[model samples]
Target: MQALLNVILPVFIVLGFGYLAVWRNWFSQAGVDGVMVFTQKFAIPCLLFNAMANLDLGQSFEWRLLSSFYIGALSGFALGVWGARYLFSRDWQDAIAIGFCCLFSNSLLLGLPITERAYGSGALTANFAIIALHSPFCYGVGITAMEIAKARESGGRASFFKVLKAMFSNAMIVGITLGLIVNLLNVELPEPLGEAIALIARAALPAALFGLGGILVQYRPQGDLRVALYVCVISLTIHPMITFALSFATGISVEATRSAVITAAMAPGVNAYIFANMYGRGQRVAASAVLIATGISIVTAWIWLTVLP
Candidate 1:
């Protein structure tokens, strides 16, 4: 209960404030979009850059830890695709978009903040480690699968180069790549520049959370209630359960297990809808899944926090 109150509720409260402000017309949707743009493109990238630049790569990037989390993510994607096609009768394009919802957890917005509050700042190394590959890996899988699906539907060849181009062109990937270059070369930024990055990084989470709330207000549950709930089940439950079993089987440290399971436990990110919208498929399911799963996670996360050692 204390964890729920102290760790989880505050995060949701910030999200709720954003939702309330938007719904009540106190905050314009345009303002919310600007905040999201700043956070996603600028502030959050700075945060990742700082984390990657300073992280002890040797200590943090454990293969077992990464594999455990990613395997679960992959399973969720596979299952989401299979279920959407076989069970729900969605087309390949829509299935791929739905599968992406299961694949892309909200690692930045919800995962980092909740984990930080529950454990502490020192406990974030594994979280950062997982995040380092998250955007690239998820986007890589999603775009590739979608391209292949598109190719099959139209009887054309999938564009491998286009996938590569899209993956590298992302701002988050750019920030992460630059950070990696600096880390590998042991390049130290000027003190003033580093401090400036720190200042921007500090604003990333809170601003992102508020913007996320406002965004959610725009994604009210529409049609496709059943399929959306199906996505919610896979994202909020199955993903974390798989991570939990694998964490113990692999004998990772307790902290790594916590980070993996908790991150896996987060709702599908807004990127899920963006991916669906990008392809003009499964937009309703993706949007509703994001909103519904986020609400469901308020309880589910608390439950997982209690379950985790």
Candidate 2:
């Protein structure tokens, strides 16, 4: 309870405040435009660059741990596929979106802050590894899911392998590649350059949260309360299960890995929905997942600590 009050609740409180602003008509439906620009133009880039550039590549990356995290996430992905197919009566497109929402978590904007808050900077390396590993699934499998979802609209087969090619070429892949290359090379960015990056990274969190607020305000799940509830479960429940299983089974140092699992499982990375919107794959569903999962994670995280050994 204290953890919820001290750490997670503050984030949601701010977000709720944003919702209040929306309710007050402080901004028209169009009022979010400025904040959106600030988020994309500055915050997100900064956050990504800061995380990548400052990554302590000097610290040993435990391949076993990496494999554990990957497999855990992969398991979530598979479950998402099966759940969407047999349970939802959804066509390929909706299933694709549901799977994407269920599996690909918000490991960036929300992940870093929450992990740092709960477990401290010590857990950062593992968090970094988790977020870094998310790309292949997002761009590769997630995008492919979206493409096939769309392909059915045309009554044509979307070659699964071809979608992999498109996924590989996504901008997120390019951004991470560029960031990693610079980091791995041990390039010394001048102080001024580093300052610029820091300025951008600083904006990522507030902009991301506020943007989330704006988006949720814009897209409420009206007709599909059932679908929204379904999203809340997948986004909040099953995803966390995967993270928890991986953290425990891998013998991860308890505090760090547990924190990672709890928070990462809570929300869909904003980028996931951005990619969904880009591909026109169940954008509404993705948006609702991001919103509701993030909303409920506050209580869920509090409960997780109680069960911790």
Candidate 3:
């Protein structure tokens, strides 16, 4: 109960404020767009930049830890695709889009904040490690799967260059790449510039949370309720269970297990819908899944926190 109150509900309360403001016509969709642009394009990138710049790569980047988390993610994607195609009777392109909803967890907006609240800021190094590779990896798999699906549908070849261009063009990926260059080369920013970035980084979470809630206003649970719930089951339950079992089997540290499981436990991100919309496929299912799964995760995350050590 304390975890629900202290760690979970506070985040949701901030999110709720954003939802209520937008729903009541007090906050314009334009304003929500601006906030999302600031957070996704600038502030959160700065946050990732600073975290990556200062992270001890040798200590944090464990193969076991990464493998445990990613295997679960990949499993979710496979299951999502298979279920959408076989059970729900969606076409290949739409199935791929729905699979992406299971693939991309809301690592930044939900994972970082929730883990930080539960375990303290010092425990975030593993989360950062996971996130550092997250966007690139998820986008790589999603774009490739989508391209292949499109190719099959059109009886044409999938474009490799197109996939690379799309993956590298992401602002988050650019920020992460630059941060890696700095870390690898031991480049230090000037103090004033560092402080300025720190200022922006401080604003990333709360602002992103608010913006996410406002954005969720646009993705109401309208259609494809069964398919949306299928996504929720995979994202909130099965993914984390797989990660937890693997973590225990591999005997990684408790902290790594916590990071892996909690991150896996988050709902599908807005990128799920963006990817679906980009392909003009499964838009309703993806959008509905994001909203419904996010609401469900309130209880689910608290349950995971209780179970984790």
| lDDT per model vs. reference | 0.95, 0.67, 0.94
Task: Give per-residue lDDT, candidate 1, residue 241.
Answer: 93
Please report the candidate that would top lDDT against the real structure: 1
User: Positional deviation of 220 in candidate 3, in angstroms?
Assistant: 0.9
Which stretch of 10 consecutive residues in model 1 shows the poorest summed lDDT? 168-177
Task: List candidate 1 segments past 4 Å from native.
Answer: none
Predicted candidate 3 versus true structure: per-residue lDDT over 1-309, tens digit per residue? 999999999999999999999999999999999999999999999999998889899998999999999999999999999999999998888899999999999999999999999999999999999999999999999999889878887899999999999988888888888888899999989999999999999999999999999999999888899999999999999999999999999999999999999999999999999989988999999999999999999999999999998
Candidate 3 segments whose C-alpha is farther than 4 A from its true place: none
All models, RMSD in angstroms: 0.7, 3.0, 0.7
Give the Å shift of residue 288 in candidate 3. 0.5
Q: Each model's TM-score, in the order given?
A: 0.99, 0.85, 0.99
- Compared with the true structure, what per-residue lDDT tens digits does model 1 show for residues 1-309? 998999999999999999999999999999999999999899999999999998999999999899999999999999999999999999999999999999999988999999999999999999999999999999999999999988988899999899999888777888888898899999999999999999999999999999999999989889999999999999999999999999999999999999999999999999999889988999999999999999999999999999987
Q: Is candidate 2 or candidate 3 better by lDDT?
A: 3
Candidate with the larger TM-score of 1 and 2: 1
* Worst lDDT 10-window in candidate 3: 169-178
